[model samples]
Target: MIYKALGGDGAAATVVTAAGDARPGPAVELHDPLELLVPDTEDDYRLTVDPDTGHLGFTSTTEAPYAILKADPYLGARRKQTIPDPAFVVAHHGGPAILERTASVLGCDHRQLRHSWDSLRSQGNMTSVSVLDVLARTLDDPDGPRPGEEGLMLAIGPGVTVEAARLRRT
Candidate 1:
């Protein structure tokens, strides 16, 4: 029941263009997008299809939460090495616990992640669109990143992959 409650359906879209493209009102300049598959944890989280019904399903092993928790060290290291002190954080709505842990590692206060929490509450976990949904919400937020401010986006996926990107509002 708890797991089911954490899931929700949603869809979102965004515009992407080259650096030299014409400005579309305001835009986010993307930088340093990194996707890293955590070693030895590939099977921790997975998607499966029911053979009889052909319905897709999600599964996680007992080690899944622990494996995810272990990402804090990597997150911290990356923060120090490359990630800027972002004014906003648009992250996947994995769950409240995961969101809390991510904020802790990234040194983000609750306000910085308010949009992510709101997205999770209203839309559950929308898989691929989760972060995009959060980003959309962030863009509409009155307190969201201002022009010239930096933002960070984060997501975890099937391969136990951690993807991070730097976004600057322009």
Candidate 2:
């Protein structure tokens, strides 16, 4: 989705699967009702819940591969602080408060975070596909980010996983 938002064909991005224990366990079945918790801290962490699908995701920088990816020079060089406008933010839209907190953390204007809400409002939560839906909505916006602009893509999943990318509009 980030590649698509950046005007790429999604060809360059590599997909790798990681092995880990993410099962909620016998005590807490995957179908059990759950609430996401995000602590107040400086860490890059986020929790998202899809009320419609009853899916809960927890992501944090402490996770090894994502942490390593965040540290990679190529990706790290494009951190939010380095972007001029902070105009594009494609993320899982768990709810209003999470979006607000994300905007604050990214130093992005609340208006820039509208795409996610628009997606959520219009389509409900689509789980892993939510970020892609948000990206599609962003692309459909007439006044959206233009070529050469920078953006961020964030997605959280069952591994308490976080997938992020920095994009340069093409």
Candidate 3:
């Protein structure tokens, strides 16, 4: 699905899975403020507020930069996974700010990150399908990254698990 989405002509492109592992579980539960919570005296669970702060979100300002800084090691590790000098990066579409921050940390240009934002803007968040959607858009673009270029594909899911792959355009 990802290969086809990324304009694999069925002639050459290759997708190689990197690491796949599930974390134990989240120590905290994220809650929506608008949702009512039943009062529970038995269980002690920390309910974290949704990070989405709407128009006044910290993503555009402080949080994203801090996150990028904190994620440097992880990014470096991903880069070290045998895929050298990837020219493109396809990540799960969180939001424009987060995507921009990720691209900045990855040393990707605005044009490379635009397809993910385009997918977000045009179709909203498609959850698990978001990265594929972005890949489809990238493949559809005439001026998108081309053959011989290497790329990295990544997605973060529940349990703070990440799925990543290395690809070489054919």
Candidate 4:
């Protein structure tokens, strides 16, 4: 049950996601696997992503492991800054295939993007990571977009997955 950090607004259940299927996907905020997953303790934390370098990290606003997360996200936007939906990325065919296809579409590193995707799951305990949600929301008109254009791509895997949006260098 991965959650969207809505414009730094608390997780909103309604905002659309670029993510696709979740095995036995649970509704947002629904906790059916509580019996198997450990509960999280309350703590303030911040994580920011640097698309330029593929750096994913976190900082805590409150305590130990947390403070590290809270440490300045010097090189990139702060955790609360919302990366927009993809105005350029395209949806690839399927599986890992999407990685290279999307990178080609957005001009990002395919392998680095793949690592970023895997990092989401390995680093944080996100239930399911969203790799292409931001792009879809920004670029495609879910209802349908211009001809020859596909919405942003989304892929979710076991570990926190790479969830990113495409942006044109302005």
Cα-based TM-score, every candidate: 0.85, 0.52, 0.55, 0.20
For candidate 4, the per-residue lDDT at 86 reads 30
How does each model score on lDDT? 0.78, 0.53, 0.53, 0.31
Q: Write the per-residue lDDT of candidate 3 for residues 1-170, one digit (tens) a residue.
A: 32223222313232433224323321111111111122321122121234574321111223322344345566666566545566776776666666776776677777767778787788765655787777766666678667666777765433233456665555
Which of the predicted structures, 3 or 4, would earn the higher TM-score when compared with the native?
A: 3
Best by lDDT: 1
Model 2: clashing residue pairs? none
Model 4 ranges off by over 4 Å:
1-94, 111-115, 119-129, 132-170
Q: What is the clash tally of candidate 1?
A: 0
Q: Residue 71 in model 2: shift from native, Å?
A: 13
Model 3: CA > 4 A from native = 1-70
Worst 10 residues of 3 by lDDT: 26-35
Error of 3 at 51 (Å): 24
Q: Tell me how far the alpha carbon of residue 95 in candidate 1 is from the true structure, in angstroms, after superposition.
A: 0.9
Model 2: residues with Cα > 4 Å off, grouped in runs: 1-85
Candidate 4 to truth, TM: 0.20
Model 2: weakest 10-residue lDDT segment is: 25-34
Clashing residue pair totals per candidate (backbone < 3 A): 0, 0, 0, 18
